[model samples]
Target: MIITRCLRPSFLAKPRLPPLSGCRQFWGWLNAVFNRVDYERIKDVGPDRAASEWLLRCGAKVRYEGFDKWQYDYNGLPTGPLGKYKIQAIDATESCIMSRGFDHLDGLEHLEELKLCQCIYIEDTCLERISKTDNLQKSLRRLEIISCGNVTDKGVISLHSLRNLEFLLLRDLPGIQKKEMILELLQKSIPPLQIELDLKD
Candidate 1:
């Protein structure tokens, strides 16, 4: 926000001040030059805004908190902050995070780690949506689905497309009855995924 004043004595002879006219021109030029850049950091309003804000307030330099569409890729690693302040991880443990709510996930392209611990609302369909995220295929490295009672083998298998995943934690999930399918596909995979499972009865 810059304010500039121009003085034009000759134009002041008329009813309107020529100085004000020049000031308006300068303001217009300023807007034209920087209209595209986001000068003010906006605090977005959304369901996940609280979560994102919590992270930021706790010294997490996160710019966006999600529940939108997969606009960016799951970037960075387990804990290190990335180049951009985009969402790098999601912790929906015991939260209201659900399967149908994944429409918002499409916007979280920079998400890397996702924790759905005790999220009873999520199901295999959520994994289906996760698999579709372009960034998940390239950037997502860690996925944790613990005690999500609705997820099954089919849903767990849906994550097979996340090729870059390095760690997968599935514990206390009674929904995933057949663990072999998941283990066979990911445990000894090309990237050698590190996994933790407790599907046994």
Candidate 2:
């Protein structure tokens, strides 16, 4: 009697991966796709709509102008009139938004409040970009940045451009050095702005 064993070919065998590796890869790919900026789509749907789509796709929530309920689901996005529904507030906690996608916020004249929490991709350049935006500088009122480790004093100080900003809240930002000095500068630059911080020296 001859014993024969069947062995799977190396090429056909599945590669071993660490726990949640596949899931991580999938999420990374999805985030990359969500962050992609399509200029044609922006021109077609308008900046608010395009920005809303991007925010929703990246696990962020948006509150439309005059709407109390937040729009979080990508599939359930409001569809009535393109320019009618303007973005009023954005909650981009743990979202995949990067500096490249900042262009989507250019023409959002009604945007009032923006919260960025645990957004690992946010950096000084991103803050500088939004701070310099003419529309955001005029319209934005409240801004909250929490646990965004990449934000530093340079980025925080650049927010002085938001001349109309009424409130600023910052928490758990390890990158921000000279928090007291930054706060003083902010106070001097924007006299009416109120800032709240939970930072360590």
Candidate 3:
């Protein structure tokens, strides 16, 4: 895969903080300018205070790690205009990543990859969003849910919509009960998709 990391511009002046009520609009404008560039990978380690909000603003794919104490409501993250680039991967293994709602990922048409390692609260509804969004499932290619206790058969079934998927890795999921569905989805969704299935019941 082609990976590119472009540093945020240093000369551009940061916008003034808007009120909480206008968060959506603020996020929309933020995406308009920063979301156009495509990047294969991005890591946010520093505590910019606005890191979470900024992430929502830019449709850039990112890898977030090392901030175990940082906390943000995922619903607050921006989803941009329909079909805009949304985050493709998130490594929250070492951090406290919480979703305010499953709809936080709604409208993320270009998301292709996702990693939610060690995120404790993600549930089936979040996965349902994956299946419900035609763009996400059709475009998604890789997915990794490791050591996440809440993901289950229903969540696995959500992947059925991923027709272009190629790689899937599920590890340490003790609650997933639909192994047959998982295998069937992989087989039917994308006959050629490379997959790795691991379950501990």
Candidate 4:
């Protein structure tokens, strides 16, 4: 799997390319001779605006950690007709959003691991969308939500649908007051699935 890294704009410009003419010539010549590099390194080439476009063009596994917002173009995420997807992990911790963060991600049929840390606005509704994904019961294995204050029993209940899930981690969420209740629900939902529960006030 090709790993594409997106760097900040300030950092991209610092690389000090020789000039557009040199870059164009080098790329033109390289393309003619080689099979094309699987990994394309991009820095601040355009707003995150072009990020989705590039993902489609390359068809490579992505690790995008920073974006201006929590919501992204739905078309960019892997979905049906696109065949198996290959995003190993996504860390959208501090990004901005009003509600659930997984609605647009329903198409990622091959997503194995997901992380939402410090996304304060994420709630049960977001988790509901994630649970509804196709083959999610069999595809997803690990899920982690930390410091998401709005998450509660409703969200925890939604997670019960992940039948094939192996690891679940929840921490510092004020809404889940009854730790025992949460544990009971999980035990009943997917009794054989291993879980890691943490509630420290």
Best by lDDT: 2
Candidate 2 residue pairs in backbone clash:
none
TM-score to native of every candidate shown? 0.58, 0.88, 0.54, 0.57
- Model 3: runs farther than 4 Å from truth? 1-88, 94-99
Clashes of each: 15, 0, 1, 1
lDDT of each: 0.62, 0.92, 0.58, 0.59
Q: In candidate 4, list every pair of residues with a backbone clash.
A: 100-126
lDDT of 1 by residue, 15-70 (tens): 85579879987854543332222212222433233334333222232334343433
**Candidate 4 ranges beyond 4 A from true positions:** 1-85, 97-101
Cα lDDT tens digits, model 3, 105-144, are 4434445667767765566766776677666667677888
Q: Supply candidate 3's per-residue lDDT for 135.
A: 66
lDDT (tens digit, per residue) of candidate 4 on 47-161? 1223333323322224433323333444655333322224444555554442322333543455566777776447788788778776576788888888888888888888888
lDDT of 4: 0.59
Considering lDDT, where higher is better, how would the candidates rank from best to worst? Answer: 2, 1, 4, 3
